[model samples]
Target: MTGAKELDRFLAELTTERRLSPHTVSAYRRDVGTLLEFCAREDIESLDQLAVHHVRRFAAESHFRGLSPRSIARRLSAVRTFLAALVEQGRLTANVAVHVQAPKPSRRLPATLDADQVASLLEIKADDDLAIRDRAMLELFYSCGLRLAELIGVNVADVDAADRTVRVTGKGAKSRVVPVGRLALEAISRWLRVRATLVKGDEQAMFISRRGKRLAPRTVQARLNHWARVQGSPTRVHPHMLRHSFATHILESSGDLRAVQEMLGHSSLSTTQIYTHLDFQHLAHSYDEAHPRARRSRRRRQKTK
Candidate 1:
C-alpha cells in the first residue's frame, strides 16, 4: 500500500475502533508519518517495498536530527505497530520493523524542589478573583501530584471539601480520588467564594479563564512561569515539576512507595521507584555535609594541609 493512504487508514482505525485519545492518535500519526517521509526520501515506493535497513536508516536519521533515545523508541514502536496491522490485512508479508531496536532510554531523575522552595513558590496571596483561582490551581497541583491534563479536566463538583478529597480524571480517562491538603482545601474554598464573579455564563469547570470558560493549559503554564521568575527560583518551574516535588517530598517523609504510586495514579511500581533515586540524591548530599569521612571532609583537609 502507498505510504500516505495506508497511514491515513491506520490512524482512522486508531481513532474510530481503538478509541484512543486525540493526543495519542496524533502522536501515532506523527511517528508513522515521519517514517513514510523517510521512505519517500529513499525512493522506496510503497510499504511492501520498504526493508529493515530503511527502518534502521530512519532511526539513524532521527538520532542525527537530535531526537532522544526515548523518542526514537516511541517512533520505532509506532512504525512496528503500523507494519503489524498491515501484515494482518495481508498488505505486507511480515513486520519488517519488529526486530528493530531503539536505544534504551536512560533513567534520569526528575527535578524536585525542597519543601522550603515549594512554600516560597506557593506564597502567592489571593489578591483578586483571578489571583485566588491561580493560588488554588497551584495548591491543587502540588497537593494532588496531578498531571497537566488531569488538573485542567477537573470540574467544580469533582472537589468534595467536606471529605477533603478530589475526584480527578487522569490519563486513559481513568478516575481516582486523592486527598487534598489543608492549604489546597483552603485555597479552593477561597476561590469558590469568588468564582461566581468570573462565571458570566454556565461554565462548570473548576478553573475558569477571564472569558469565563475553562482555563487552558498554556495559560496555566504562563502564569506558573511568571510566578517562578517572581519567586527567584533557580529552575524553570513547570506543572510536572510541582508533581515531582509532591512525589519526592511525600516519599522522603512517609517512605511509602506503594502509597505514593496510588497517589500519583501510576499504573506500575517501577514508574514510582524513580523517586527513590531522587531520595538517595538528598541522602548523598546530607552525608557529604554531615559525615567526617565524606569527600566534603577530604576537601577541607586538603585545603588545611
Candidate 2:
C-alpha cells in the first residue's frame, strides 16, 4: 500500500483501537503528513522501502524548516509509532524510524503564581452571576490541580459535596477522585445557587456560559484573564498556571509527590515530579535574596563598596 493509505489505517487504529483523543489523533495526522511529504519528494513509495537514513534526513529537514526541537521530536515519535504498527502488521520488515533521533529539546520550568498571587487572583467578588461562576471555576482549578480538559469536562454529578471530592476524567479517559478544598466547595455551592438563574435547557456542566451551555475552553481562558486583570495581578494568568500553582503549593507543604500525582491525574510520577523542581527553585530564589553568603547578595554588597 502507498504511504498515504498506510497512514489512514494507522490513524484509524489510533482512534478506534487505542482510543486516542481527537486532538491527539489530529496531531498524529499532521505529523505523519510531513513524513508522507518527505517520502514523495525522495520517490520512496512504500513503508518497507523506508530506511534509517531517510528518517534521519526527515528529522534534519524538519529542523531546517524551522520546526523547534520539541516539534521535531514529536513528529519523529509519530513516525516511529506509524512505522512500528506497519511492522507489527507484517507490512514492513522493520521500523526504520526507530533508529532516528531528533535534537534534544530544553525543558523550561512551568510558570506559577506564588501563594500570595494565587490568593489575590482568587479573591474575586461575587457581585453578579458571571462573577460567581468564574470564581467557582478558578477555585475548583487551584483546589484540585486539574488539567484544563479535566476541568472543562466536569459535570454537576461529578462533584460529591459530602465527600468533598470530585470525580474527574483526565487524559486517556482515565478517571480519578480528588479531594476538593473547603473554600472551593463553598465557591461551587454559591455558584450552583445562582446557576439556576442563568441555566437554560438542562445543561449538566459544572461550569456553564451565560447562555447556559458548557463553557468553551476559550471562554474559560478569557474569563480567567479578565479576573486576573480585575484582581490587579502583575502577571497574566492562565488555567495551567493555576494547576502548576496548586501542585507547587501542595508539594511545598506536604512534600508528597504521590499524593500530588493522584490529585493531578498524572499517569506517571515523573510528570508530577516537575513540581519538586519548582519547589526547589522557589527555595533557591529565597536563599539568593536573603542569605548573607549568597552569591547574588554578596555581589550586591561588594558593588555597594
Candidate 3:
C-alpha cells in the first residue's frame, strides 16, 4: 500500500524471482532508491501514483547535473527493470518507464599498437626469471587475444605445447581451443621449463608470482606497464591493449570477421565489427598508395597539353 513497502517487495522479487546477481541487485537498488528520493521530493508517494512524466523529469535533471549518457542509461535501465517487476506483481497497472527511451552512448574505438610497436614489445629480452615470465604473459595476451582473467586463470594442464594450442575458459565459462603462434609457444615453453625453478611443485596454475603463487591481475597489469615504458611506447600499455592489437592485426591480415569473432569469444558478431573499422582504415591507406588515380603527377599536366 505504501511506497516503502512496495519498494521492499519489488527488491525481494528482483532477488528471489528474477534471480539477479547480488552485485546487480545492489546497483538496481541504488538507482531505484535515488528515483524514490526524487519522487519524495516531488510529493509523489506510491508505485501506483508514478507517471512517465516523473521519469522524464528525473532524466532531464540527471542530464543537467552533468551525468554521462552511459551512466544515465544504466540508471534508467535499473528503473525500467524495477518498474517492470512492480507491474508484473500487480503493484502498478502498467510500466511507464518503457515509453521513454534512454540516451544512446557514444561508441569510442579502442586504441591498438601497430605491428612494429608490438614487435618491439615482444622482442625485448632480459636475463631475470620474472622478465621471462612477463614476456610470455604479454606474448600470450597478444598471441591468443586472451582476457586478463582468462590468461591468469590458465592452469598447467590447459596448455598443449605439442599441438600449439591452449584451452581457454572464457566468459560464461565457455571453453574454446585457441592456437598459439610459434613465438608465444616458445616463450611459454621456456617459462614452463624454468617455472619449477621459480615456483617449485606448484601445479595448480600455468603462471605464478615469485612467491610460487598464482599471479594476480594487478601484478600482471603492473608488469605490463613496466615493460611498456621500457620499450618506449608512446602510451601506457595494459594486457587488453595487447588483446586489442591481436584482434586488429588478425582481422587486418585475414579479413575473416568470423574467425576473429571466434578468437575473441564474442557472443555477438556486432561486437566484433568494431575491428572492421580498423580494417577499413588499412584498406583506405593501401588504396591511396596502390591505386593509379590516387597517385597524382608531381607536375600539373602542363596545363592542358
Candidate 4:
C-alpha cells in the first residue's frame, strides 16, 4: 500500500478498534499530518524511511516557534502513537519516534479565584429566565467543584436537595457525590422555578439554554467570561478556575488533603498534592503576620541585644 493509503487505514483502525473520541482522533490526525508534510518536503516517501533524527528536528523547530513544553510533549506523544500503529501493522521494523525524549513540561501553578472574587462573580443578578439559569450554573460549578463536562451532564434527578449533595459522573464514567453549599442550593431552587415557567418540556438537565435544551460547555464558558468582566476580576474566568478555587479553599480551611482528593474525584493522590502547595503558601503568609519570631521588629531587637 502507498504511504498515504496506509495512514488512512491506520486512522480507521484508531476509530473502529481503539474507540477513541472524535476530538482525540482529530488531534492525532493533525499531529501526524505535520510529520507527513515534513517527510514529503524531505523526499521521504514511506513510513520506514522516517527516522528518530527527523522527529527530533521537528520538535526542535516547534520549540523555536515558541510552543510550550506541554504542547510539544503532546505532539511527540501523538507521533509516537502513530508510529507504533505502523509497527503493529508490520509496515515498519521499529518505532523510531519511541526513542525520542520529550522535554519536561514546566510546572505552572493552577489559577484560582479568591473567595471574595468568587462571591462577587456569583452575585451578578439578572431578572430574565436565562440569567437565572446562569447564576445556578456558576454556583454549582464553584460550589461542587465540577468539571465542565460533569457540570453540563447534570440531570435534575442528580441533585439531592434533601441531602444537599450532587451526584456527578466524572472522567472515565466514574460517579461521585459532592456536597452543595447553602448559597448554591438557593440559586438552584430559584433557577428551577424560573426554568419551569420558561421551558415547556421536562428536560432532565438541571441547566438549560433559552431554547430549553441542555447547556453546552462552550456556552457555559462564554457566560462565565461575561460575568467575570462585569465583576471586575483581573483575569478571565472559566469553569475550571471555579473548580480550582473550590479545591484550594477546601484544603485551606480543612487541611485535609485526602478528603479534597476524594471530593475532586482525582484517581491519584499525586494529582491532588498540588493543592497542598497553595495551602502551604497560605500558612506561610499567616506565619509572617502572626508569629513573633517572624516579625521584622522582633528580629531587629534581638540583633541589637
TM-score top scorer: 3
Model 4 lDDT per residue over 43-68, tens place = 88787878889889888877888888
Q: TM-score of every model?
A: 0.71, 0.70, 0.73, 0.70
Angstrom error of the Cα, residue 198, model 1: value is 1.4
Q: lDDT per residue, candidate 2, 20-98, as tens digits? A: 9999999999999999999889988776788889999999999998999989999999989988898899889988888
lDDT of each: 0.91, 0.91, 0.86, 0.87
Superior candidate under TM-score, 3 versus 4: 3
For model 1, the run of ten residues with the poorest summed lDDT: 193-202
Of 2 and 3, which scores higher on TM-score?
3
Ranking by TM-score: 3, 1, 2, 4
- lDDT for 22 in candidate 3 is 88
Instruction: Compare candidates 1 and 4 on TM-score and give the better one.
Output: 1
Assess the local accuracy of residue 157 in candidate 1 as a C-alpha lDDT between 0 and 100: 98
Candidate 2: residue 235 Cα off by (Å): 2.0
Q: Evaluate model 3: give its lDDT.
A: 0.86
lDDT of 3 by residue, 44-64 (tens): 867678888989998888888
Model 2: worst 10 consecutive residues (lDDT sum): 1-10
